[model samples]
Target: MDCKSESGLEMQNVCIVEDDDAVRDALAELVESDGYRVLSYASAEEFVAGADATQVDVLIVDFRLPGMSGGELLKRLNERGMRLPVILMTGHADCDEVGLGLDVQDVSFLTKPCDPRRLLGLIGAAVDGKG
Candidate 1:
């Protein structure tokens, strides 16, 4: 389903699910600047309850959230038959531990204080069905 933005450009809708207000805002701004429409959420549960879930082309989630973890959210989405691409972000230095929590085949895991360019690249890959 191709979605057109008000600017007349093909816009990919991305959902940013993070508990931290600053991180969410920053991520939203960055993604928007990259020409994608972003919907920022405070938690996985909040995103799950919102209508934007079905409309997003990709989901950018934090590994640890207040209500539900990113992995758990992925599990729930899978069970519900939603095939949205997800990217996990974490502040932890242990990639192995993060790997253990994520079981999805195409998930992209990035460390916290993520580089904006790298995040944009990952998001493009995800939206292009390459992640």
Candidate 2:
């Protein structure tokens, strides 16, 4: 979907990297309703392979995946000089543990089943350069 604003201009691109089909679809719906372009991926590898740094403004990723983890993806993105704001979600009690040894910045953490309002607020802050 094209990220379009009310003034017929482009909006920030928000990517969702979620392995779970249900979660990915749900998030896409919610974020799209909020007017940002939603690019949903089933895995971090797909996102890494297909994402365009110039277009993406923020990322919402699942922290735990079947293969590469969210921290690894964030590190890879940073290594590639993307530097987009990110929100990582997980069920783990200590999500920060995954970020150990990573130089990731402009990142926020969210537990699974996060409040929709909170997620939207974070995305707004990230897009506005206030994250």
Candidate 3:
């Protein structure tokens, strides 16, 4: 069977839930450059409503959001049984506290203004189900 989707998109897709347009676009560009499909959302609600859990290989979310935070979103995804790998980005000094007990698997945190290489590496790891 072919791995690509019916739309001819790559099989591996990364869902980015970020409210910041600049940050979201930059992440999407970087992810796409690595040959993976990118699905970006302005809010966790939008992501949850629009994204297909089965199609997403990994999730990249911002710690702070307009309504539901990244941790809350992670919990929501878990409740839906979509245990995709996750990466959380934030500028909050206590971002770790916000994500203390998320129920998802293979989760990692990235501080805001994260190094491009680090972000790429983290995404690569998540895609491979390692981190």
Candidate 4:
């Protein structure tokens, strides 16, 4: 799946880190259809273990995971100096919790059942350093 820009450059890679199988699969399909290379993980631990953090252009992470929370994962990434744009998804729309996650400059929060198009656009912006 080669997604080219106007200058004929390949699109960046996007990683989806979600616990739900259905959501992971669906998000992967949607992102791939948008012309970006997509990788899916069932948990934050799996993603952090398997994926090359440097290769990741954007990360779509669910706030609640089986092992570690999304914010915890982000904190780890920060400690390692692994900088990447992250979009956080959560079932809870708590302003305080979301605000805490937003303390990271490159992080964004999305409520559950997010619009696919908006998600894609945000991914694009993240990769382009425009978010």
TM-scores for every candidate against the unseen true structure? 0.86, 0.88, 0.86, 0.86
Candidate 4, residue 90: lDDT = 78
Give the clashing residue pairs of candidate 1, or none: none
Candidate 2 displacement at residue 4 in angstroms: 5.7
Put down candidate 4 lDDT per residue, 1-131, tens digits, no spaces. Answer: 23455777766889999999999999999999988888888988998889988878899999888897787889889878888899988776554665563465488778889999889989988988943
Q: Please, what are the lDDT tens digits per residue for candidate 1 over residues 1-131?
A: 34687778778898899998888988999999988888888988888888455677889999888878887888788777777788889877546566763465368888988788999999998888732
Q: Which ten residues in a row have the lowest lDDT in candidate 2?
A: 95-104
Q: What's the lDDT for all of these models?
A: 0.81, 0.84, 0.82, 0.83
By lDDT, the candidates rank as: 2, 4, 3, 1
User: Candidate 1 — what's its lDDT?
Assistant: 0.81
TM-score, candidate number 4: 0.86
lDDT of 3 by residue, 1-131 (tens): 23487787656778899999999999999988987778889999998788787777878999899999888888877887777888888785856476566744568888888888998898888777632
What are the per-model C-alpha RMSD values against the true structure?
2.5, 2.4, 3.1, 3.4
lDDT (10s digit) by residue, model 2, range 1-131? 44567798877789999999999999999999998888898989998788776678889989888688887888887787777788988787756576674555678888989999999999999988842
RMSD of 3: 3.1
Model 2 steric clash pairs = none
Q: What's model 2's overall lDDT?
A: 0.84
